[model samples]
Every structure is written in structure tokens, then in C-alpha cells.
Target: MLVVEQLRKSFPTAQGPLPVLQGVDLCLARGSSLALMGESGSGKSTLLHLLAGLDCADSGSILIDGEPLDGRSESALARWRREGIGLVFQHYNLISSLNVAANLAFQARLAGRHDPQWLDYLTQQLGLMPLLQRYPEQLSGGQQQRVAIGRALAARPALLLADEPTGSLDEASSDEVLALMLQLVGEAGSSVLLVTHSPRLAARLQRRCVLHAGRVQAGPV
Candidate 1:
């Protein structure tokens, strides 16, 4: 459902415009998952940000289900971010003042697509019912990550963008979190584009692509 064509981006540097993503092409089918692997500075995060609409590519195009992603106004992109996509990061960006239940429901409420049934299902699957009243500070890393994943999937987003989602946890915690994440993503039927450096983690996804020298290539990074 996602297509990127010769996507190119560059950033300002002391020398000049330092190119990052150079003619990167990618495609993701609906409800499928893709792992983007790269060493440091390979522009994996940059490509993810561009697809997330948090940043724009300097040239080329990104299409989702035939709709062009380039040239949109800030407001339009903001709306798309709120309603059309779900995002998770290494850090759990939960609202400190909000408890687990509120945080889980936050995005869904914003999208005007809140579903009590879906939220309940997530709560049950994530084993979050007992922790519903707790805040982020009171939870463990795995617990926090679970809440983050639940919040992202609460809206049943067509796509989910995750960047180093399990970076903060220990090995066991990371494995557990990733497993739960993939299971919930399947239940939610959301397409995933995950940016991570771990090959073990990348292997769990349906497809893996490496970013090297600003271009996407098949196989390991």
C-alpha cells in the first residue's frame, strides 16, 4: 500500500548540501511488515521520517494507496499524522500526566475513531488491564513499550512507523516486546515499517532491506 520512488533528500552542512537518501526506492504491500536495517548514518531514520510525514524528501515521491505524499501543506500532513499513521520510537513518548488507559485511548480519540471494543482487545492481549491505572513512570521498560504499541495500534492505523522501538530494553524484554508488537500489529492489520539496527529483530519481519550509501538494497545491512 506504500510506494516510494527514487526518494532523495539532503541536509545542510558546513560543506554544502550533504545528500542522505539518494534515489531510494521501496514498496510495502498492505498489512505486510518491512524491516529497514542500516549502520549508523545510512539514512534509515531519515527515510522513516520522510515516510512518516514528519520531514519531507527534497525530491521524488512517496505514495500511499495511490495518494501522493509530497507537496502537502503542514496542516494536511498534521492531519495525516494524527489520523492516517501510527508512530512509535525508542523512547516511549507517553504523556506523563496521563495514565495507561488515557494514553492508550489518546490517539484514537484524536482520530475520532475511538472504539471501546478495540481498546479492550488491546488491553487484554497486552495484559494491560492490571496496569490501566498506572502511569509511565510506574511501569517497567517492557510495560512502557507495550503501552506505546497499544496506543499506536488503538486507532487501527493503516500503517505503523517504528524507529528502534525496542532499543531501550534488555534482551529478554526486547524479545517479549517485539513478539507482542508483531502479534498486535497482525491483529490490528496494520502495515509496519520498522527501522532498527538489530539483524535478529529484522529477521522477525516479513521482509528486510538494508540502506547503504543512501540507497535501498536487498538482504542484510
Candidate 2:
């Protein structure tokens, strides 16, 4: 489960401090999914980063399963991120030097949760079995994105944060990848907070929240 209370973040600008998120509050139950929809600059990605501990909130608390992340040291946060969070970005930030197989197993190995059977299952499910030996540059956009998703889920982290994961793919590929991701996340029993701009994509999830005026609208999702 994930919880956010009065989450506020501001970035320094030439003019002054520009607030992105102000007093935002949201929660997602364990094993559930929530789609975070917002326009550009609505702080969707900022919120996701805070949840992943990639960035610190100016003020507020982010709790994962009742553990607060506010006061953790960088070393502690890094360990927590490696072990507890799975992140998928739009760019498919794969290691170009590593082949698909290595990339798929990278995070799981780092988390010390590597399972060959599970990795094989993920490869099969993501339609990536044949491309395992290829590097990131050799695969199509969809294939590469699939590998990214596979890598994120390979470790079976408690929470998955996907930031516009399908933004680079065509509609058909986007639909395919998103559907597969949801199915696999369910199988892995991990909570998901997917940030996307598409209503069609957001609607597919069990719950949806729209960010506006620096805070999340609606209640529990």
C-alpha cells in the first residue's frame, strides 16, 4: 500500500520558487492499481519520483506500507528503491551494453530475488524469448519497451511506478504493452501507480485520479 499526505514540492526558478504539488493526498491499497492523470506540469511525474525516492518533497510524507520515507538517508533510500520500487519510464532506460536477457534479470539480481523460472515466464509472457540475445538498440520500440517492463517486474517489487511508459509507442503497441503490464503486475501481486495522459489508458486501471491546481482531485482510489 502507498499513502501520501499534504505532499508539497517546489523548484527554484529565476522568478522564485515555483510550487508544483501543493497539499496533495492520495492512497492506493496493496495489490491494487491507480492511474494518475494530469496535464503537463501537474506534478504527476514529480509525485511518482517522490514515491520512488528519486526526489524529495519539500514538505509532506510518503509512506509505503506504513513506513515513512521522509527521514531516510541517501544510502537507506537507495537500498529501499532497489528493493522496494520498480520504475518504468517512457524512454525505456535499458542498458544498451547489456543484452535483453541481462537487462531483464538485472534488477532482480540486484534485489537478490532473481528467479530463473520467473524470468523465463516473464520473457515468454512479454513475447521476448526470441530477442533475449539482442541488445536494446537491436529491438523495435515495442520490443524494447516490453523488455523495460520485464526488467521492472523481474524483481517483483512491492510497488511499480510507470511514467508515460507507452508514450513512445504507437497506439496498438501501447495497448498491447499496457495490457500485458497489468496482467503481469497482477500475477506478481504488486501495487501499481501508473502516470499517463491518456484517458483511455487511465480508464483501464481499477482506480483513477486527476491532478489539478497542485493537488489530487477525488478521494480514495
lDDT comparing candidate 1 with the true structure: 0.93
Residues 91-160 of candidate 1: C-alpha lDDT, one tens digit per residue = 9899999999999999999999899999999999999999999999999888898999999999999999
Q: Candidate 2's residue-wise lDDT over 139-175, tens digit each?
A: 9999999999999999999999999999999999899
lDDT of each: 0.93, 0.93
Runs with alpha carbons beyond 4 Å of true place in candidate 2: 219-221
Q: To one decimal, what is the Cα RMSD in angstroms of model 1 from the true structure? A: 1.3
TM-scores of the models, in the order given: 0.97, 0.98
Among all candidates shown, the one with the greatest TM-score = 2
Clashes found in each candidate (C-alpha, N, C closer than 3 A)? 0, 0
TM-score of 2: 0.98
Please list the residue runs of candidate 1 whose C-alpha ends up more than 4 Å from where it truly belongs after superposition.
none
